[model samples]
Target: MMGNVDIFEMMANRYDTPERIQISKATADAIRKYLVDTHDKNAIDFGCGTGLVGMNLLNDFNSMLFLDPSQKMIEQIKQKIDDFNIRNADTLCFDFEKESRTNLQADYIFMAQVLLHINDVELVLSRLYDILNVGGHLLIVDFNKNDEIVSDKVHNGFDQNNLTELMTKIGYREIQSKTFYFGSKLFMNHDASLFILDSRR
Candidate 1:
C-alpha cells in the first residue's frame, strides 16, 4: 500500500487536471442521484483525493469530512477549504488498513474510485460499516469488472452482484448497484465503465 500512498501523495498537487476534474464531476453527478433525503446528514468522503468529488457535494450534506490516507491529498483539500471559505468541511489523513476503525461517525460515507487502491476490500468495507451510524448509507463509485487491466497493486475492477453480496454479508441492507458511466482509459489506462453501489447500514 506504500506504493499507492506514495503515488497519490506525489500527484496531490496536480491531481485536478482537466480530465480528472471532468471525471470527478461526472462521478459526483452520478452519486448525487441516490442522495435523496441526505441534506441534513453528515458525510465522509473516504479515500477522498484532493476533495474533488466531495467538494462538489458540500452543500448536499450538513458537514463533509474528507478522509484519506494521503497527507498531501489532505493538504490539498485543506487549501481548497481555505480558498473557498468552506466552514462545514474538514479533513483527516487516516488509513483504515494501518489503523483500526476510527471513532468518526457519519450518516453517509462515499468513496469514489477508491476501492481499487485498497489492499483488503472486505476488511476496509466492514470497518467503514462500523464507522457509520445506524440507518446511514454507504455509496461507492468504482470501475465495473474489467479483464484487460492487470496489476499487482490494484484491483482490475469489481462485479456489482458480487460486491452487493459481499456487502450483504457484512450486514449492509437495501443494497442496489448499477453501472452509470463509461469512459475511455478510465481504469489503468484501459477503457472502462464505472458503477455506483448504494448500501445501507
Candidate 2:
C-alpha cells in the first residue's frame, strides 16, 4: 500500500503533467455530456486529483465535495482552482480505501481515473451507493479493456460486459458505458470509457 503522503505527492505531480491534463479534459467533457445535461448542482468528486474534473463540474454545479487521500494532491488542486479563483468547493483528504460515507453524501458522485486502483470495487461501489441520495448517480471514467495499449498496464481495464456484470452484482442498475478519445491521434483512438450507473435499482 502507498503511504498517504507519497500517494498525494505522486498524484500532484501526475496531475501537473500534460498527458494527464489532456486526459482530464476529455474525461470532463464526456462527463458533462453524460451526467451534467440535467445539471444537478450537488456533487462529490472522489479521488479528485488537482481538481481537474471538479473544475469542469463547476459550470454545472453549485456545491461539490472534492475528496482524495493525498494532502499534496489536494494542495495542488487548491492551487489550481485558486489560480482560476474558484471557491465554491470543499476538500477532504480521506482515503476511500480506508474510509466510507460516514462523513459525506451527495446527489452525484464522480470519479475519474480512480477506479483502476481500487482493489475492492464492489465494496467501494456499495459505500458510494450508501452516500448517494435517491435518484443519485455514480459516474466513473477509466480505461476500458478496448484500449489495446495501456490496457496491459496502468488500468485494470474492463470490457462493457464485465463491468455491467460487476455493477449489477453490486446492486447498481441502469449501468451504461461509452468510449471516447484522449490526447491527440498519437494516443489510442479510443483510450477510455465512461461508465454511468444509477444507484436506484
Which is the leading candidate under TM-score? 1
lDDT of each: 0.91, 0.70
Relative to the true structure, candidate 2 reaches a TM of 0.81
Top candidate by lDDT? 1
Write one digit per residue (lDDT tens) for candidate 1, span 1-201. Answer: 423999888989988999889989998998889898887899999999999899999999999999999999999999999998999999998999886766789999999989988988999999999999999999999999888887888888999999999999999999999898888877778999999999999
Worst 10 residues of 1 by lDDT: 1-10
lDDT of 2 at 70: 82
Off by more than 4 A, model 1 = 1-3
State residue 111's C-alpha deviation in candidate 1, in Å. Answer: 0.2
True lDDT of residue 28, candidate 1: 91
List clash counts for every candidate, in order. 0, 0
Q: For residues 1-201, could you state the per-residue lDDT of candidate 2 as single tens digits?
A: 322346557657665677666767777887777664445457888888778877777878768888888888888877766787776788888876676756576878888867766766777878888888777788887665554555332454657678778778877777777767533343345434444433343
> What lDDT is obtained when candidate 2 is compared to the true structure?
0.70
